[model samples]
Target: MKRNRNFSLLLFVVFLGILFITFSVISVEARKYRVKKSKPHKHQNDRNGNGNRNSPGPAPAPLPHYPTRSTIFDVMSFGAKGDGVSDDSKAIIAAWKAACKVSGATIEIPSNFQFFLKPITLQGPCMPNLVLQIDGTLLAPPNVGSWPKSSLFQWINFKWVQNFTIKGTGIVDGQGYSWWKYSSIYFLQKNSKHIPDMKPTALRFYSSYDVTVRDIKITNSPQCHLKFDSSRGIKVDNITISSPESSPNTDGIHLQNTQDVEIHNSNFGCGDDCVSIQTGCSNVHIHHINCGPGHGISIGGLGKDKTVACVSNIIVEDISIQNSLTGVRIKTWQGGIGSVKNVSFLNVQVSDVKIPIMIDQFYCDKKFCKNQTGAVGIRGVKYDRIIGTYSVQPIHLVCSNEIPCTDVDLIDIQLKPSPGYRGFHQALCWNTYGKSQAPLLPSSIDYCLGKNGDPVKRIEKSHEHVC
Candidate 1:
């Protein structure tokens, strides 16, 4: 009887152990299911209050400005020949001058014709609610030899304007092929210092307020396609800018000393930075952009030449960059006192990019650079949902040793090497500090980035990437 009772006890113990093992397996599977569903999707906009956006449909171009047609001033009526060969600069200027006097007026360039213009300035203390509608094409004179020696480097200048809209399906062609002969990426790289300065950008707005630019096609600029300086409350939507990959210094859009600006639904491919944010800029938002075959988007070599600079509250989201040298970057000169804070790059996708994320505290573009000590303070930056394939190193965060980058956070980052290429052992970092959470691929990097993590101290330094 004793033997039978002992055998019964042993079987009961075995049954309980089996039951515990089964329950543990079920609990682990349930927890993993919950975590997978909780990760973030792309946000709707960087500016708006909407939630995450998921595979939105195509967006159509909006209509032109809603100015009253009663006070219309047509360029053709002011002796502007629409023959594509005549000098129409004087006539276009006359129309702008006349329309500037009337409220809600429109300077209309009608379709079915082309106008060739030399350099022109459309000065404005324009009446409120003015619109410049370009339904026809405007061609720029390609003769750089005859241009004035001293210049503002702008083909069309809209100065001191307020409460205006410039919209249409028309094209602005810079005819920049002649300018590109000696000004290409290859030539500039081969001959380090002797690059020729290109001509003017197609359009520039100086000290403007409450402006809207929509539905325009700008092509082949000598410098940047469009530029804005010291402007407030600007919006640019549904614009297309294109140039060859080799075109030198042909940035798509450049801004300096601008505030409260939004650029959305745009496409850009040029030699230089697709969108460059210079000094004294704040509250800028860029969304739904497509960039390709160019240098990619960048925040300035701020504080250059030992100048003070400031940029803050910038956001870039839902962007696609392919075949570009970089995905998102911030560069600052070595000898300057300034700060870049509250910058966020979210939901960016890239393919074949050389460097996906980079922060260079020492940025030098000249033929020679003299190292100095003063540095820009960089803080409060976040990288979220950056997924892509990179041609070279996936991440580079080189901050100044004196003023280390603080509060840099990374979440949901997944990057791999480009096809058929050998992946690097780890990300490169120097004098950088950051934190990372789960959902980061190459999970080993998590070991590198912790609270106040410095990669150089923990990992071996590499000389593979020199500046």
Candidate 2:
């Protein structure tokens, strides 16, 4: 009887175990089913935002659809004139206007031909979501004065527009060599009276959102290669800009009064700063860029008159500079009231550069650069992982009198120059107060001796002294 009772007990225990296992498996399967059932609904909600299953077919297709009419050749032929003297700007403008009216149309520039687009402004305070597609060369007028001012600035304002794109495999040649010549001549003559008509930019977008300019070759711009002024949400990718390094004021990209701007995967060889960020600009992220034979990225020469300027929260990373004048710089005038703060540089590589990093607060221009108070001040700057191989010292720091720089940090900065060049170093510092406590050199004695041949111990923590 005891054996029979033990057998019954064992069978009951096994049965209970089996029931628990089955229940656990069913619970897991049910949870998985719930998750699977919710996934599509979640995606649908993301797309529709209101959880409506029937939300207007794929957001009504972006404004410019492919395979549309070729507006440049088919619509505005203008007798295939390759020179800007043909007066095709009116026809081109008309074609652009017509194509823009029709949603999802491509204004194509046919290949194997050059279209000399005289200075013509393509102004658009128009509807959102437009695309300007180019496949042929849009040549600029060889004569600088012949290019109209209206076409350059007033054309294609694009203010308050969204989802605008400019994509092309073709070139927009500014023919800026002549313009540069004129500017030089005008400056040499000191002929302020002539006011040689201002040449329009190659591409200018203002107050626009979600804009993309990609895969285009822009060269020899009379003024700025690209200007983003008072605009937001811009992306410039895979674009190439080139000009003579001596080309006067030919900045690759100039941003002023803007926010949330990103420039990546681009190459710039220009006359001025590859990228210049001026007043009222913030949240700028620039990465994967190759800049050379020009000024690296810069913020200001700021605080002219009472015009307040502030640039903050900028990041420049993964950039390669070759033979540039300065790698990364923040320059402010000697007597202006404004502040530049919260700028960071990371993982930047440099070769053959004059100064890999610089902060010049004593920025004095010709004629009126008197030692003035409140020129501008820099604060909260962080430089990390900056490596370079060059002839000159890799770093320079200068601060102005009266208002000193504050909160500057240099972390993990490894700079080694080529043989027989000045070692990795720092230059003149006046009224500069900050901490560079992290020694980058391999030797502690060398670190104690500042690059300017002064003992680092005397100046390590002082605020008002010049080095």
Candidate 3:
């Protein structure tokens, strides 16, 4: 009887244990259900107030400038150290993402801070007219090791964004010393494919529209300090771009497949062209710029690799170029088909420039180029009130042999040799048909012509293309 009673007691304890285990499992399942039901909605988040009720769709019309109260997303608030040594790219990107979702938003990089950044692309079809208010310095990494494999083409890129304004007095510093050194060695060896096919541009806006970049300073670019590719409605004002004169391919402002651009009141000192207008660019106006220690404003070396390029209606006026390579130039390659027309340079002043006025259809930067017959057509180019001091010749016009340049005009031109002892100054011309107005200096412009190599009579001037 005692053994049976002990067995019953053991059965009772096991039953109590099973009951407790069952209740614990049910409690765990209930908690899981509650947590799942409490999750936030997919489109709305409380952290940044993103996906709010009034946000516009993709590619909406530009909003009025700073409508209502601006929502500011300071990078410092998003975990940026801003000490120039820490990697602030992720924090800055977080700020941008939050700011891009709201209208009249600003991503502010405050003053007295230096944000060290690697290659970063701020891509958007985000809220229109967003402003990047930069008041601090943005410094790039010092070496190529910091660049990712995919982001070798550009250091800072704004892609597919519209109505964006980048304003304020900040410095964009690209530490390009290592890149310049490596590129120099590669050119000397001529066989190493180590560096990527194209060096990275400092800042590039690709396929963006209605962009305004103003009141900023950029320096030490690896290549092409500022570039606008396949973009429209650009306005650049009150900016300064500087790079070492020996830096390779560091153009101040490079435009390709872009149109409707106006650049004014800027300063540039670089290795390559101060402003390079490449293929498919039209309706451009560049004025009131100060350029030095670089190649002057140029159009083309275009239609490369037997391609067709069409550029028209460009006006460059009220410019000053000092201690530069070439002042105003139009260059195209051989074996290319296209036309560059209705271009005018007015009120330009150059000091100690190499060549003040140049038009070279056989523009070959390489050591040797195969001679080809087909060439791009150049017509209706006018130069007016271009007074300068030149180191080399005053003008050099070498047009295409197959299709000679036509309707070229030079008016009120005066160019003298720089203050030095020695070297004759003469104008060289070939296969270009043009007329020169009176008061042209040095009497060398008499060579400037018609199809029969005679001075073409000036007809009534047509209305110039209004900017």
Candidate 4:
């Protein structure tokens, strides 16, 4: 019985020990829960309070301070009034000065503005890729009296610039009416040499490289609408040039001593040659042009004043000429010394043109030019796929007797006489040596035939010239 009582006491003590261990575990868990409830998450504390649990979140990474892809220098920001009457030349010059220092800079002339600019030459050896974005109209001073005597040669001139671009759908209006009137009266005089040369070209690039002028409309120029002289790597596209049909000497684009030129997809309605290729020009490609009411593309009047000239590698293709004086003509003065070689005219369509294809070596512009013996050599000229109607003649190839044209080729030419044309459809050829591939429509050039009236074979001539 005593043994059983001792066992019961030991069992009661074991039960009490088990109850105490369970209470201690529950108390420790409660303390842990209280501590967790008192503390807040780090992110939540950072949002609700100034400091983080340890320190404030690092200050937001400062935004990078650098120029955008292309920095712009707007003319308006340079104090341009933009009113038609105000002089904006100063503002434009300021913008260009700022842009010239930075590479890949664009000088922006904003839209809805008519800026009257004086005769100015923007000279540059600027940072690469300088751009002139002309979204507004740039007007030359209206009155001729406003121009200084020295500035009458060019209205807007770009000189010595490289990798430059002038673009945007804007109008460059040379208010040339006053100058034209003065010129008309001056030309009527018997001896006009005394009259100072007053007409100014609308736009000119001199000694600039890799220049591009596109998407611009130039109108009513006193002289040439656009000119590149002593420049290289020129590209002119998608531009419109216009003037009165009787406006004299307003060639659409005049190239002199410029090489590696490309002029395409442009429309021209002017008084003079739509494109005038002067001396020292080569590797030129002119295509997809619309020309009318003007003299068609011309290569010369080169070697004037008994000077030496050289031109080569010219290709004019896919052209449309309507109501033009002549189509695809190369003219050189009588006394010039040069070699014009490797010129091709392909796929040209004409409507009411005076002469569809011509090469006039004895081209005399004045009333009377004294006959001279020396001439510019014309060789390797090809006219292929020339089709349409001509008002005066189908073909007139009058080369120089001194240096006759050689290796000329005509293939697939179909030029019909225009309606109401009573003259005979004849092709005139003199001092030209060439062969016709297929039978020319309307009339065949008998000059390209042998004495027995058969197509003559071309004799390869030596083309080395001193010029």
Most TM-score-accurate candidate: 4
On the 0 to 100 scale, the lDDT of residue 7 in model 1 is 97
Each model's TM-score?
0.79, 0.74, 0.81, 0.83
For model 1, residues 86-109, the per-residue Cα lDDT tens digits are 999999999999999999999999
> Scored by Cα lDDT, where does model 3 land?
0.87
On a 0 to 1 TM-score scale, where does candidate 2 land against the true structure? 0.74
Instruction: List model 2 lDDT by residue over 1-467, tens digit each.
Output: 99999999999999999999999999999999988874554345544454456543335446785784442333345344544356556667776666666555556666666776655555664445567776677777777556454464522234555677888897887787887887778767765655465656777777777888898888888878888888888899999999999987788998989899899999999988999999889999999999988988888878776456678899999999888888998988766666787899988998878778788877665665566665455667877777876567666677765656666666666666666776555444455544554556423312322232133223322321211
Backbone clash count, each prediction separately: 0, 15, 1, 0
Tens-place lDDT per residue, model 4, 1-467, is 99999999999999999999999999999999998865655456454373445655546668999966647999999999989899999899998988999999999988899999999889899999999998899999888778888898999999999999999988999978877777777868837654556689999999999999999899999899999999999999999999999888899999999999999999999999999999999999999999988999999988888888789999999999999999999999988787898999999999999998889988888889999987888878989999999889888889776777877888888989999876558788887877787757765663452231123212213333464
lDDT of 2 at 302: 82
| Model 2 alpha-carbon drift over 4 Å, by segment | 1-85, 148-160, 192-199, 418-427, 437-439, 442-467
Candidate models: Cα lDDT each: 0.83, 0.72, 0.87, 0.87
Quick one: ranking by lDDT, best first?
Answer: 3, 4, 1, 2
